[model samples]
Target: MTVTRDSITDFVRTLEDDISRVAICGTSYSDIGGVARVIEQQAIELRNGGYDIDIFTLEGTRKPPEDVSLHALGHFETSPYKEVDKLLTLASPSALNFVRSANRFDLIITHRFPFSTLGHMAKVIHNVPYVYWSHPSGSSDELFEGLAHAWARVQHHLETQNYAVRKADYLCAVSEESGEYIEAKTGREAVVVPNTITESRFGDVADEKKINEQFGLTPHDTIVLHVGRISPRKNIHRLIEAFQAATEGEAECKLLLVGEESMPEYSDRVRELADDDVVLTGFVDDKTLAGIYNRSNVYATCSLSEGWGLPLSEASYFDLEIVAFESIPAVNSLDGAYPVVNEDYDEFREKLCEKVNRD
Candidate 1:
């Protein structure tokens, strides 16, 4: 079935009559990245529409909104070996048992791997239908470079991710590129439901004074902002280098990097490259994030790839000048954003300088 943006809400509404109880499954509910935000938004919207929404996770940190139920399966371990933890979660007998004993769900919507495996289990054991929401495939060659047991991780990702896609009763992707990737890899059609931004969430006026005070910024500072996880795939090191070159000798200009660090080692390297002029504000609340966006002069990213680049859409809502690389799938989808050649640091720097100095 073809699900256009106009029909997305209608399609979901149709499900409400038959599917009264819905379960959203993911690894976590924290505001660590875009996936968490997407799950939150989905839960809120479904709950508001009178659907009985329940969120299942391996670990539950952040609280769900009012009237939304949260269930933590307690299968995740706090281990230094992230890959091992993921493997355990995927093969967790406890999680499978939880699904077997828990109240039957009318439908399950899964976000990503390991948890998507649970949705598959529900379908097999309880005859429940599941929808897999495909995000960007994290199998980029750049992501595996210089990593230990890279081949093993890559193989595991391919096997599990492909299994989820193939087993899902329905598939939906965050962007057109994501949908195409799904078809290319698993020969499955995915409905394109692009991530959205609620303009009303952001204030009409930016709390410049609050942002300036929080980040030690002056009114004269020309801020270049990047909001997302600080990970190797994001290419934050390259962004910092380009920002430095772009704003060299401009004392009042600053670069603000937001969001939590997903990869500690890569984040540490990025921190090493950042001088005093660069501020890394890790994991802010929504209100502070809104203030940060509203007060910023430009929104910039050097991300090698993205499923949808939710931050870019949010930045557009704030009317900030966007600077990104043309090679990014999300950048190509956006209008009026400046895109430099992929990995061309000199061109990226030049473009950043042009946009930063424009205002």
Candidate 2:
């Protein structure tokens, strides 16, 4: 079922207004992550449509686009302070404050999974509704499919988080898998807003100049772009092997793992395996990422699972052929990329060669 906030009463669209103000709430936009990029992309589209946009962040780590207006809301606890957040969310006093503060927005959209519970509480407290962007990675049956014998506490947190997803005005996600998951948990139909890829990102920019200068890239080098937080869930190790295999005989191929390194150990592992052909940008800006995408020949993602792979869409904008696995959600998201089934080394290797050599 669809719900609306008290402030957003205007059903009629004003075509003449040059500024359509929109607010985006989320955990962190600093890492150039999926949720951040989703909101940012929409904000850009609206701005291009001659609408003024506003993005509200509790932490305010990342800056909004130059054209978009920015409003800083109250800050919340980080990952380490999860318990504190849960406590404040439950207590009536703190909950009342949350409602009072967010009542001003015409439409408040949140990316945090637990914030949906806040949205439910806020609607009752302030009569202001909220739209939730669904991207929860865990299954309701479990936090994740594969887990150890331990993690009882983690499992409990996962269950409580579903309460948030279960309550929201509008549920939006990038793919059907996540949409289905949100519907099953929220008892609401979710809109499928596939990730976007504009033509401008596949061009040169000032951010690339900074990255090239800092990373020591030659004009002739072909950088293979992997844009995301370098995490195990991302299956970064598999990408290493695939890139390594593809660049075996190639002269200019270089694997560029953009975004900050998730862990120092993982960062070290990347270095241990790389010859001189690998470059780690470690949290490059958006413009740099776009330039890297332009200079890149092919894009590859070795994720075990993905609700929606945003980079895959970005690659499509540049017409870069994809080399991915033939899994349910992954294959479905690739659109028309060459997907090789099975994770066997040889099978993956053969497919990798095919993608890299494509004319």
Candidate 3:
């Protein structure tokens, strides 16, 4: 994600005009996620643009920063409480009703999930101009011919996701590469607006030492951090394997998982992985997590796919050298994120060992 300053300047230009009312819809709004954080960043900017942003959340009441003026309207999952939320997503009927209630908005900006399907309905039914926000791709069609995947669910997801993108009045991608991928997939050129940074995590340097102490880590320990859903798409298991492999001889390395687990089986699997070196502190506060980022010896993810890796960007903000698989949407941004080809255990080991030895 090599960006010319002009592109950022131009993207900021679109916000000059005052926006009145906007329905910012997404499931992850209340949770700790890269995409959710990206959406939260936009909600703040839109609020500054004079738009009163009304959020349709799937769950939780975690408010956005004060300057952003965002409010959650709903929640979806129950267990980890923060488990996957589906606010206003087509998968839920409450979302359908929100679209009806949100008809007064001048525009709608959707991120990830249900927004794609609901945005179209918001337009066709209420005459609202829906803006489709693209984040990251969770697929690699390199193995498949024209279709993204031969698996029925993967194929269905693409077909459905394509319909949602093509139906939007305007599309804003989190990254230019994602925009190009969307254009090639849907025959519609989307506008690229990569995820912006909040001053605390990006503009200002974090106190890693302060944050690490709060996480119960000694100054000498090397804490490897991962922040994303504990779901399958994040490729957490692979990260565990890599970490286990990377730290066999290094006695000082530790791994900390910051987000809430997403599924029963997934949680069980991860819990099963608990041992001397791994710490699972499910869903810490943003301030605390930022502190942990500051204290990290290295930050990494083996995310198999993404719309864009928000954590990766945040990791870069802290200047922590990262290690990740290069295929993820955010791979392009990780100049410091040492990438290994996905599942290339050998190559992953090589990179991990190099980073550890260099550290």
Q: Which predicted model would earn the best lDDT?
A: 1
Candidate 2 lDDT tens digits, 1-359: 43322112121132123224445666555546777776677677766755556675444566677688665444445444343444344444434555577666555567763355666666666655566776653433222233321233443344334655556666676567666766776667877665565444445555555556777887766667777777666667778888888668888667777777855666777678767887777886656677677667777777655566778777767667777776424455555576667466567677777766553
Compare candidates 1 and 3 on lDDT and give the better one.
1
lDDT of each: 0.78, 0.61, 0.68
Q: What would the per-residue lDDT of candidate 1 be over residues 111-216, giving only the tens digit for each residue? A: 8767677777788888888888888644655464544357446644643356765888988887777777776777777788877764444655548898999999
Estimated TM-score for each candidate? 0.90, 0.75, 0.80
Candidate 3 contains a number of clashing pairs equal to: 12
lDDT of 2: 0.61
Give the per-residue lDDT digits (tens) of candidate 3, residues 30-85. Answer: 65666567666777776665557776556536677565545454545543333223
Prediction 3 global C-alpha lDDT: 0.68
Answer with 2 or 3, whichever has the higher TM-score. 3
Q: Tell me the RMSD of model 1 versus the true structure.
A: 2.7
